[model samples]
Target chain A: MTADISLTPPDPKDFLDTDSLFDEEERLLRDTVRDFVRKEILPNIADWWEQGVFPVELAKTMGDMGLLGMHLEGYGCAGTSGTAYGLACLELEAGDSGIRSFVSVQGSLAMFPIWKFGSEEQKQEWLPRMAAGEVIGCFGLTEPDSGSDPASMRTHARRDGSDWIINGSKMWITNGNLAQVAIIWARTDEGINGFIVPTDTPGFEAHEIKHKASLRASVTSELSLDDVRVPDAYRLPGVSSMRGPLSCLNEARYGIAWGVVGAARACFEAALDYSLERQQFGKPIGSFQLTQRKLVEMMIAVNRGMLVAHHLGRRKDAGTLTPHQISFGKMDNTRNALEVARTARGILGGNGITLEYPVFRHMANLETVYTYEGTNEIHTLIMGQALTGIEAFS
Target chain B: MQVVVCVKQIPDPSGTYTLDPETHFLVRPDEQVLDDTDRYGVEMGLQIAQAHGGSVTLVSMGPKGSMQGIRQALAMGADRAVVVDDADLKGSDALTTAQVLAAAIQRTGFDLVITGTESTDGYSGVVPQMLAELLDVPALTYATEVEARDGKVTINRQTSAGYDVVEASLPAVVSVTAGVVEPRYPTFKGIMDAKKKEVEELTASDLGVDTSLRQRVTAVEPAPEREAGVKIEDDGEAHLKVVELLQQKKVI
Candidate 1:
């Protein structure tokens, strides 16, 4: 005979014990990143957001924590499991998307290209310091007119003896203002080639983009490469064409898929707290059926987004994750997070529009996250192409 | 020099707790974390070891399945850990805890022992002294700043007034109070490295120590509820009423 055993109820925050999917090490690492974000970022983020300044000093601290290039192997990188890195992204993004963007640009965009396709000399020179946050790097791929179509980028590199001279501008570059070196992808006589251009080069200038309503805490810049010259040693001797930049985008897009979950969770938690403390009709607003339904929706969306992120992270670790799947996660999770943030903002009523609560800030930040990496429309097309075998982009 | 830190894995203080009517013991929550008080001790031990060319070994006693606290301390840069876990050791008093810890520390062999002056859960504030007596070492309590040099340890011991500069020979036990030093958060590398670090588990029988309880709780009751404060309505003499209440409480 089997005796009756009582099952414990699910935690509303974790609801499904999604944490059980990770091992102890992953959880501990996640907690470490969470604590770091809580202690370092959360308290000061509002002021930073208001000032439109991302402290360049924190790059060193994050590098010290081994968060920079944390998923990559060798060169003083942490080489942690992909799931752990994604968990770190979740926690960091929970503080603010700008902080998470800082890490994503540093690790996936800037450092990843060097680690993946750079020469031994380049890797030896940059990876260790970049991983330690001593040197900051930014990717120069998106041009003023070229957002979705990198093949249409006007930045061109021409051979001058053994050296290559580049001329063009890249817009909306994260970490551009502070980058010591920039990985500028320019179309060459051969194909698209990536050049590691030092910022101190005579023709390299970065102008900070101002008046951003969303992602205000992040540094967005317009890079002018006016006859920037670099030696052949600086060119990444890897695959030519769009593959190099596309792979790096895939890496960052995967992180974005996980990062926005944190933004959504932050808004949901703020709304939940406000609902409980806010009183109307002689009781807390949370007592109402409509409010509870919104809460449940946010809770389900956050948890579902987390599960998708975890599943993709596991596949990435197993070396089986496909690009279309990443696009799927990025599109779905970003859309869901935006929806959750909007719903949470509605739940907060008048207070939602204010910066006093994180709801509005997260909602605003999710607006940018929705547009960057790959827009929801672009990702949908990627999914559509994968499903129906039709190349739709003109 | 070898510094061994005594850590306790207490139920997370932030979580709710309940009392067992049958046993008169506070039932532990499912979540366990390192005692906040003991962090200073562990940090001090790590600092001493880093400066003096040694390592910090963590020693803890808890239920058989609890390793979260020890793992956390290890992640904070402790070299290794020795945990004494056994079901038979339940309901062990302060003296019995001292015995089990003394036995385990003897095996670990420490040149210095560090612990919190008092645990957050058990406020007896007597374990360090008892452990020192059992180990036949001098006990220094309430250390806010610690320094080890020339085969000796020096501490700024907190007292009724300010603090006292106390010096003791090596092989002594030091109980650190909070705010000695800011504890460092574990880096990602440290967390991964902690998984590979050695954690030697032992039982009370393995330690060959007495597991007998020396004290029993005769009664258990909830703390008395505090009385509500007097509310003075403003009648253009609110300041005078506040002054009178303060005077009544001897605050002015």
Candidate 2:
């Protein structure tokens, strides 16, 4: 039976109501994902972290909820708008960067290339399976010897008739071992290109990265592809050079710009609420000047990051954004979010160090964040070069 | 079943929309989402469509801003949306708004229509019945259970006493209050699908509005001031005293 809609308009203040900026559909989707994250990911986040196991079920759950490839339109994707895509990242990362990383690897790194850069057959063969969570995808770029500088990687691919053989190793790959397909970045005769290398392919192996203190709930893997042969059709047609891998970075980094803010928000809100509720010296710690200052500072950072990401998102949607602009957002927001997480940990005192509180987990996750997706120094150099017309990285 | 759900975008309740000094009466459009009561109406429309294998077309009468409510309905799995937008329709009184909706209903050829018992802004409970009058259709107010089986609408109406179930034929209108079935939360995927759904827009002229009909808002503002309360200690004695006070005030 249909429930009577109380048209008595709710006091708009009751909901987040990001309606004007987003269409009704997008805003509602944002809220729905937000609510799901809050209910599903937040409560068990610490437990999963301390145990050194991601709620592996979380990925499948997210996929079941149609969170995977939320922005890629059609082809079994939710085909959400840019804002919805951003907000989903925000909510997911609010739980932990590791969980966010899993999604990033699966969507931007894996599914996106096949959809945007791969052949039609590749898209048809992979998209539905990826969308259904029947198959997972990961991107292989950062080599073991290379962290910030992927362009200098030694991974290479050679053509043999209708097949190409690849021999390379990728490090710091999220969802690596668990994924069915890996969009391996390798130096080909055509320069750096992408190949859809299945994890089950001959001479392909991915072992889960072990003993990681940061992003513990995330499944990080290192991949070794030795003489892994795939058909020529597996090559990404939309990409001919280094730009292919770099484009994936552009996508991941944009999500990180929004994702890290969620990290900061979780830390800041945790500190704010904890400080208010945790009593010290016969009053709430939030009543103390030092604590209040930290909270206020964190708030300023989070809010500022939100505003910056919002504009960057608008520019992206408007088709006016450039790689340099994206770098600026990623750099500024990740740095601020890392600082916020650290300070939030400080406010929590001894309790902050434990996985029981979100502060420490977020703080540790930000360490990985500060280094990934172009790195802090890389972004700075990109912006510097854009400003002065000088390539400082060289 | 061609079910039409009337929704309005109002202020976020938490915002406590303050009135604009110049225009009065919470001048800015309520931080808009689906009207709470009207959301139930939307769900009812969708439910009817789901069970009967028909289309649910969500409609709203307000400024273009009202499209948010329509989109929300669409995300709730409504098949389509119709938006009635116009400048003169701004701050429309209940009767004039009903006339506009009645005309739109005629154009759309609706089989069944559902609405909230009252709008949150003015809490005006006149719309559904007034709209029914304009359309010359049978209207049921405060419906609890609405069952459409074999060309008959069996409605259980909530009254001051309890409930009164009645049967009505096709082309009927109903208003529902709270205590209906639990409304479903908009799923993330549902919202994603809604973006692809079409939201067709209509205007006051399309609704065949009479400009002569009153559209005046001389003053609008927030509720009256609330007095400060005494700070009660979080102790057993204080708690007991609070309980006693509640009992004394007949609130227990």
Candidate 3:
């Protein structure tokens, strides 16, 4: 008897012709980010995840490619269309959610606040360098006890002569340990204010969070500020309420709505390849109806997630995107993506539990992604409030 | 020091491509990309122009959607682009392509012209020489490296034995081989700026060139498959088996 064994796996499954939806420029941007991921991230990601360390040099590489603050206008930003930015997020997250988080926190969380609300000096000082990736930044709005409810944060900023002294702690901060700057949101006498604190300051400390099973390839840290003082000019002069931080979260959540789709696609592709190559009971497992069902469900979820993301992206570019619409996208896409990842893992059998395959890693990463930047529960309530005009969140 | 780089849009080699069984011509998909080999020519042109204080202009002749390649070149820091797109240009041979490109390059007024050694799809290695003959410039093909200064150009041409150092006056044509220089990825800033860059489009009438197809593709067939070789696992007797097989083939 002759055995037919193939060394290479089958090509990835693309059930939906997604390219028809994007313009040429948007497709180019997605391809560029995808190429970068293939070259830079995919080869070393497994080891990085095993060690729980983010590659520090990727900041400069990504900065050189104009990924940091890619969607912002001026100050050395790429100023691409909103749809292009969403596509980039999708491709980056397809490599790993941690890589996408690094970009989202830089562009949407840190640089966005400075660009949207900071003083002219603040914008002039940080935006260009941040866009160039010479300086890395993180958003400090989530505290140990203030997650899901940001208005209850205990981090406070007090006025001391011409300087504002900030004392607070931010947990679950992506790129925190490696960031040179932190946009810390704290309660002030006027209301909640955002401070651009240099991490090298006298009282600023960032300790890496250890023993994390999810987002292991990313840098997550706890930031503690003890009387960190900066000039009054450092405060974002545009807004004085929690809306400042909330708006930034809205932008990040929009990226997440696209990013989780990438994660789900990665898992689905892995499962599809594994199923086709793996044989059981004298036949390839993918030929079975149950395996085909799993693949089809995953394909539909991935495509639907991307469709919602593209729709919201166009609305954002047209300036007609409402927060509630974004809430719907974030809630639906993340929940569906998490389910897809879990189902894909189930299809992979014992191999799904190992780091050698991307399915388990994405499944693990989506767990944290599901909870952060407006949890699925929080987004559902947000949509509920918008529809019923009743505050179910309280 | 004005430089012109010839570019083309081709199907991504990593993706599947099909040829029309009836026409025997390439049936391209909706997604077309800049040819990877041509990127070296664009990169070289940009670097030489930047170092010598001039602008790099891209000249291409393809279908309507071929602007994708020109835009990609522009995004890589080329100053502007000129696309000779016309319906009559369909099924044009390398000679016809060279004629159209020569006219466009003449209109653009270039001091130095660069092109890839060959298109990945055709690999004829004739267009650059044809373009040189049409433009009355010295042809420097298979250039591994090029340097221009003081109204003179030098090219390190690759050959079977080794390299050949060739020097030519200004107003010359050089076709670069792959790996002449590492092509840089277009930064997001570059992509944004490329949108505003000037793209001058011209047809055959505007370029004063004949676009009729002189050579036609009658049929296309896939390459013949190679026979499978025997695999001998290293089981201590593998070397003896290999010798026996070689002797059986009368090679030992």
How well does candidate 3 score on lDDT at residue A197?
Answer: 90
What is candidate 1's DockQ?
A: 0.69
Give the alpha carbon lDDT tens digit for every residue of B137-196 in model 2: 899888888887577788889978998998888788888776566566565667656768
Which is the winner by DockQ between candidate 1 and candidate 3? Answer: 1
Model 3 C-alpha lDDT per residue in residues A1-394, reported as the tens digit of each score: 9888766653345555667788767766787788789879999999999999888788888888889999898888888888888889999999999999999999999999999998888999999999888999999999999998899999999999999999989999999999999999999999999999989999999999999999999999999999898999889999999899999988898999999999999998888888889999999999999999889899889988888999999999999999999898888998898999899889888988998889889989989998999888999899889889999977
Better of 1 and 2 by lDDT: 1
2 versus 3: better lDDT goes to: 3
The residue pairs that clash in candidate 1, if any, are none
Q: Per-candidate DockQ versus the true complex? A: 0.69, 0.31, 0.51
| Candidate 2 vs 3: which has more TM-score | 3
- Per-residue accuracy of model 3 over B1-252 as CA lDDT, tens digit each: 999999988888877777777766677654577898998999899899889899999998777473566667777899998888887887789898899999999999989999999998778889999999999999998999899999999999999999999999989999999999988777777776777999898999998887777788876666899999999999889999999999999999
User: How does chain B score by TM in each prediction?
Assistant: 0.92, 0.83, 0.91
Better of 1 and 3 by lDDT: 1
Worst-scoring 10-residue span by lDDT in model 2 chain A: A10-19
Model 1 clash tally?
0
Docking class of 3: medium
- Identify the leading candidate in terms of DockQ: 1
Error of 3 at A143 (Å): 1.7
CA-only RMSD, every prediction: 2.3, 8.7, 5.9
Candidate 2, which segments miss by more than 4 Å at Cα? A1-29, A51-67, A70-84, A128-134, A277-284, A318-320, A350-357, A384-394, B4-29, B35-52, B59-67, B80-252
